[model samples]
Target: MPYRHLFKALQWGLILFCLCFAMVGGTMAERLLELLQCQPHANPALRSCAWLPNALGLRLAPFLSAGGISDYPFVLLQNFWALIAVWMVALIATHRAARNAASTAALPDRGKTRYPGITGADAGRWASRAAFWVLLLGLAGFCMAFGTPILGNRVALEVLGALGCSPGTFDPFSSPCMSAPGFWTHRLAVYVIPLAGPLLAPVWLFMAFWDILLAWTLLTAAAYILQDHLSKRARRPAP
Candidate 1:
């Protein structure tokens, strides 16, 4: 039973890890392009900006509603989906663990318990920790990629310069204009101000940074929440 539960937990960990890297991988390229001020893929519909409210129940959007500590848009939906993926993985893992426990308990002798055919848990576990570590490394890679001057592309800054992009060209989570997030320099008490100041955009990349941070923060937080929820579920009395 211990082994089975551990396997199930690790399974969920693997799935969540995969999801973490997937978000960083899928959104990096295009969002980076937008951050670099490159014209999008021909009228895609994104319009180079997106939005969502902050934790304070205040509405916010890229380049529109600004000056709040958490105000920004969710420029990338793929990251949002990755967060959802984590929840699904956890649900499956817990259910499987529960089922396994029930089945094992039902047997008279229970000499050696084994699931004949795993409905969804058929996917056996081998080395989940190794995979999880790899995913963390990949996320670091994407975070680096999100930075200005794409690795090995010595001319990246020059290219941005030639294209008239901001000198502050940064990653999806950073302001392309190098502008600081509203809360960074403010005191804890001052950060509560809504529409505290005017938002100016010499370039669109500035807005992109806001959107990226907003989405990634929400997604990562959701991932954390799912992990906690699943961990608690596995401890509950079986129904």
Candidate 2:
């Protein structure tokens, strides 16, 4: 089988996935950071940036609500779907391309050419494919991990109610103001959670990287099993 089309499809799939992730995920992350930075400030000028209270609130609502952290998983799911979609499309395109190339080939080209295992060209091709898949998979995993909690409840309160240093309630000088060490600790949590969430995601990626390896191993194992079975059958006495 001509692997060139398959290779091309994977290439395009990676590009499409990255573009979509950057456009959607990147935009959300930026706005989140902006909201976090500006919403906490006491200055009326910074707070009155038109996209205040309600606007920013709506953007952050998913992550700010009690279980807002779930939104990250939801977003990560979205990224996965995007990659899946691209991969499927690429598969179809690769099949069509292979068919077309086959149809145009010389009739005598029906015979298969055997290669001495893992030639330089073959190794290079495998390396390129591995690299691209790794890059895309890594980013998607990171999005699911880091992206989920970066703008979660703790972070939300910090950004939305940082001045109050209170939990549950946003009104700082209201009847139930938070002045105790508990309030301060909660405030510290709010600050630290958002800051650490993003950083931790990437760091955790190192651990999660095993997921990619496992997937590759399973796929390759399946291929090897099929190949071994076929090889054994070929060597069998007339069956």
Candidate 3:
């Protein structure tokens, strides 16, 4: 129950942050779109990057679509990715603290000059350091909804169909690419070309949707581990 609450809290916190991010990104895009005479009107609530300030210009969220993040779906993805980052950071910190405590306990404690917190395990520190990349990739996926199709053509198929050609007809093997009038989405089948082996398929999707599904799982696992370690710490009578 405690974990459930933590999970929900993380989810909601990430959602709230993502909404704020979307609003900021959308407002900036609207301003850009308006200046360029692309969309003409501004939709701060939606992603209409037209009259953007001269500074941002076309470089606005090069990875994410213009108005794509303004939508709620991507907001959820962003929040989830943020949660993943939080989880990773927490895990890293806890792991480092544990190692430090262990190493200190093992040391002779001669009061000599040494790093106060000496965690001998380099692996934890390294992985924890990698948390930055997790945040970066997660942020990218968060801003723009990363889609991995388990079934069906793709979520963007209809939008693509609405535009001109059928997205489904596009070669899935070559690239997991599909576009709408002003948007693009990918399916796992298209991403994991050959669509044959289980390992390759999941790995491909993991690479694409890592910020979402993989990140989510990693966060969940990290949270569990952190809670376990914290509980163990709690049970031990402090010195």
Candidate 4:
């Protein structure tokens, strides 16, 4: 029982970690863009030179950023890829832990009441719930990372305007006058492409659905492991 509780704690902790990790990366990318924009003194040639903020972004920069003023797609894709990697790692680890716990639970007991913990049916149920929760959580995480900074920047723009910072042409790291609307428009590409565009050629749907399935699989494994441990503890000799 003690270990079972620990397993649950770990599962929750990992999910939180993944969420935070994703948010952090998103924040970094957003900040980098802001930083680039603020550097008005940069060389003329370097003005338009914007690097991908994340690894995946860097990898797909050439293909995605083609003819685009802003490479928002790369940034979003990086965050998406990072989230998936983290989630997959956590799921695999949890699955292994669950398997071990289940095996331990099957050991012969001297004499005690044995109660079933996680069963095959339980796994299916738990997975469904986990998938739902993960989907919501993932959305929140992604938004916090990718959207919050933009919102903050919007506020900053308003405050600057109030303080007398005049808006100028939206230039890449050149003119101090940055167009928030333009920024948003450029960033919107990241969302539009996957949600509605023809980039994935229908593969996007599968990627979107993968989250739910992945979450279910991971949580089910964790639940089964913890339940098995609890079941084993239930049959132990009581003093």
| Model with the higher TM-score, candidate 1 or 4 | 4
Error of 2 at 28 (Å): 26
Candidate 3 residue runs with Cα over 4 Å from true position: 1-19, 22-25, 28-166, 169-239
State the local distance difference test value for candidate 1.
0.37
TM-score of each: 0.26, 0.25, 0.26, 0.30
Summarize candidate 3's per-residue lDDT along 1-239 as a digit string, tens digits. 33335555655765665565556655654555556653322222234442233223323333245445546346435424545576656555555655656566676757424535434444454454455456556655543432333422333333233222232333543322333223233433343233332224334455545556666667746755655565465468759
Best candidate, lDDT: 2
The Cα RMSD of model 2 versus the native structure comes to: 15.0
lDDT of 3: 0.45
Candidate 4 local lDDT, 44-71, one digit each (tens): 2233333222222332323333333344
**What is the number of residue pairs that collide in model 1?**
0
Error of 3 at 13 (Å): 13
Best by TM-score: 4
Cand. 4 Cα-lDDT: 0.45
- Model 4 residue-pair collision total: 1
Model 2 poorest ten-residue lDDT run: 182-191
All candidates in order of TM-score, best leading:
4, 3, 1, 2
Q: 2 or 4, which is superior by TM-score?
A: 4
* Higher-lDDT candidate of 1 and 3: 3
lDDT string for model 2 (20-93, tens) is: 44346445545665656644333332334333443443333343332334345565454355556767766766
List candidate 2 stretches off by more than 4 Å: 1-105, 109-192, 206-239
Q: Which stretches of candidate 1 lie above 4 Å from their native place?
A: 1-139, 148-208
Error of 1 at 142 (Å): 2.1
The TM-score between candidate 2 and the true structure equals 0.25
